[model samples]
Target: MTTPADTTAPPPRRALTAFAWFWVGAPLCWGLYELGVKAAQLFTG
Candidate 1:
């Protein structure tokens, strides 16, 4: 059976996993957006 010590432990590692995904995805998304804007400018010019 569980005990009080187990209850007192920190939250699980889900936040760390989420943050890792964000860390990898955010820059990739930003780069894609920047590239799209530049491509549009090239076509419009």
Candidate 2:
């Protein structure tokens, strides 16, 4: 006799969450940092 097949889905991953956060957060933080660096130009003549 053969065994039954699994229909349940896999659990979420913390590593994948961290990786996704880093993927988005890194660029966001970098853009904010660059914006801050260049923000002075807005006030300058």
Candidate 3:
């Protein structure tokens, strides 16, 4: 029922999905934490 193209499509997509999540989430979380720390410093000082 399936073709060669169909079988190849999912693996690359799965790999890319995992890569994108790690790449985007790590920096976003770090930026949020850094911003929070800077905000606290401004308020306290």
Each prediction's TM-score versus the true structure: 0.55, 0.58, 0.50
Residues 1-45 of candidate 1: C-alpha lDDT, one tens digit per residue:
333575667566788879999999999999999999999987898
Runs in model 3 with CA error above 4 Å?
Answer: 1-15
lDDT of 2 by residue, 1-45 (tens): 233457555555768889999999999999999998799788883
Residue 21 of model 2, lDDT score: 93
Per-candidate Cα lDDT values, in order, are: 0.85, 0.81, 0.80
Candidate whose lDDT is highest: 1
The TM-score leader among the candidates is: 2
Error of 2 at 3 (Å): 28
How well does candidate 1 match the true structure in TM-score terms? 0.55
Q: Between candidates 1 and 2, name the one with more favorable TM-score.
A: 2
> Comparing 1 and 2 by lDDT, which wins?
1
Cα lDDT for residue 11, model 2?
Answer: 57
Q: Which ten residues in a row have the lowest lDDT in candidate 3?
A: 1-10
Clashes of each: 0, 0, 0
